[model samples]
Target: MIPHLWNDLEGTFFPESALDYMPEDRLREVQLQRLKAVTALAYDRVPLFRERMTAKGAKPADVRRLEDVRRLPFMVKNDLRDTYPYGLFAVPMSEVVRLHASSGTTGKPIVVGYTAQDMDVWKQAIMRSLYSAGFRRADVVQNMYGYGLFTGGLGLHGGLEGIGATVIPISGGNSERQIMVMKDFGVTAVCSTPSYFIHLIEVAQKMGLDFKRDLKVRRGVFGAEPWTDHMRQYIEAASGIKAYDIYGLSEIIGPGVGNECEYQDGPHIFEDHFLVEIVDPATLEPVPDGQEGELVITTLSKQAMPVIRYRTRDITAIDIRPCRCGRTIRRIRRISRRSDDMFIIRGVNVFPTQIETALLKTEASLPHYQIVLTRKSGLDQMEVRVEVTGDMLRDSVGEMEQLQKRFARSIEQITGLHTTVTLVQPGSIPRSAGKAKRLLDTRNEA
Candidate 1:
């Protein structure tokens, strides 16, 4: 693989090539320099950072080494909310070229801006992600990730284009048209949420389209949702392609934050663009490398909306080493689950992704389901409402009951918690345009 000019510059700055080969002191020295630069920039440019640092009695000059970064106040999502809109943008509006906002399901959307250079950095980071996933110049990428405000579609689209691939910007939804384009364009690669990909597989089968013979896709870059190894195997088996995991969030820079290589071991992070740190979610103290914690990011190269020590709320670990693919950048494992997404159900920590993984393993005739948590009689009751398609029904009440029992067992096996399973008719659950809402908590009494 040919390294981009930016990658070459990154090597000079950090000697990432030596991460696995160099001494610990050397790596610390490089990180200390970068940390100081970021701290100084945040102190001088961003008002929120300046105020927080001042209140914490932190000065840019104080951050003389990597350890000093711990003295700086950590930034969180709420800080962006406190500032609102573009108050957190470091550079003036004149340099801002593009803006992307959060889906805002919780409250007011946190906005992120990009300058021309920032966009270039984003493109490079995403390109590295795609390259790691075995994308080449000859590959025809069909990006099914949503476009517009959501960064997945456009981010991957730009990176694929940057790599000189034929990018079919096929946003998301329109299952019929998506398959049609895949066949007509001879698309070799696909990018989308793992659930949406599974839904498309079923659609193709129902439409009498042969995934192996008709569709030319050989690889899938699945992201925008938490998935599992079992789900990955199922996707690969159903689609006759290798399914690689990609990771990103709009707050830190969209879908190309990190990506799994062809080896399918772990997603390598572009450390040159964004500095990653894993910290205890509650204590905010750095965890030892190779341990799971909340991922915190610092935008080292961004201009318009440079964020320092921004807490991502994502739970994952990092390996500060080069991969067999020859990329010297650090690699981050696929996110286990977001800290906020973890819910305590009767003293058991349950993740919705775990339930989704269990459901996918079963021969359940449904691609859609919702995990609803409600308080009843002073205790939390969990219900999984799944949509049953025609394939699973097949005029057999015996089979339906067996399947429901199997699903309940599967959930128990994965989560160690009992959940009521409700198999509804097809098309019962509503479809969403962005970030599908699969989990609902109605515990608070009105």
Candidate 2:
């Protein structure tokens, strides 16, 4: 890795990007200034924000310092849905140049809007993200993130172009064509979910294309779903590409809220434009740095739809220690699970990521797996159906039984809940072009 690429924050060529390297005192000064402005904007324009603040007996004027951010009303996912199409918008529809919404599989999709200035800030954030990961203007990036209402595709697309990188706008799916494009176009970088990238690795192997020898891909920017460090290691080892974890949400300006630098230690949050806080999901109280909690963000620079103390629901901690990369921006622990994604099995809180950690540790099976939750005799049960590698599938029946037992033991050790491990043949588990669906809860089924 070229550590010298973006080092020397003082000598940094780009002046607009210098906020990342400012001193902590100066960073907080800027954050406080933006915080006051955004809160006032939301309070004056967005009725929902204003109503919540009023109910709490707090006004924009209550924000005296950074700590006073707690005085502002908190915004949750339901707020966006309750507001529906445009209730939370701080500006009129005419000023909104773009609109993006969540999948809303549960109910009404949470819609978010971006003005022209908002679009510019989003692009700059992405450009900073890519630069932190060692991406330069000469890199060829294949953006496999899905486009349209989903912000992943177009978000990265615009930013990659903003940095002057040649982009292959191949929105998710079409794995075969994706591989072909990488081979023929001399693609050096790729942007997609970590799960989708694993699928690409499998496709390339089937087509007899080696990543290290055949593809010029040296770096991968992966996000859109929670993934573990084990998964990151697996991706890098299997594909021979450095994998960087990026963090963001649809309500918080898409995927450029924070990103991993070349060190891959943690993703640095862009403090100048976004104020981040770790709050206890249950108590809603702030947690000290280095302690895990729900991530809350305030869009400091967003003009069209600025959200205040927006609850992200993703669990992580902030690292205030200086990074080896010399950026003053703080980094967040990689998000592997969300509060809403946790499921209780027989009174034991279990996250899908815990199951993934166990499954990946085995190394005898592929990462393609699903958790099936069922209830029998009024007791919760979990059945892990994981796909075995071709070599493992060819093993004798006794070996397969041993593998299954090993998986069950590993899961029981970590989660303290015994599970039925069902080893399936290769390709039995469904693959996804976007976010991989890892959980299939049938306990509620009649």
Clash counts per candidate, in order, are: 1, 0
Q: How do the residues 355-384 of candidate 2 rate in per-residue lDDT, one tens digit apiece?
A: 988987776334588999999988899999
Lowest lDDT sum, 10 consecutive residues, model 2, at 1-10
Question: Which lDDT tens digits does candidate 1 get at residues 185-292?
Answer: 999999989878888898899899999999999988888877777778778888899998998878788887788866687787766566788999888999999899
Q: RMSD in Å for candidate 1, one decimal?
A: 4.2
CA lDDT, every prediction? 0.79, 0.88
Spell out the clash pairs found in candidate 1.
Answer: 259-267
> How far in Å is the alpha carbon of 268 misplaced in model 2?
0.3
Output the number of the TM-score-best candidate. 2
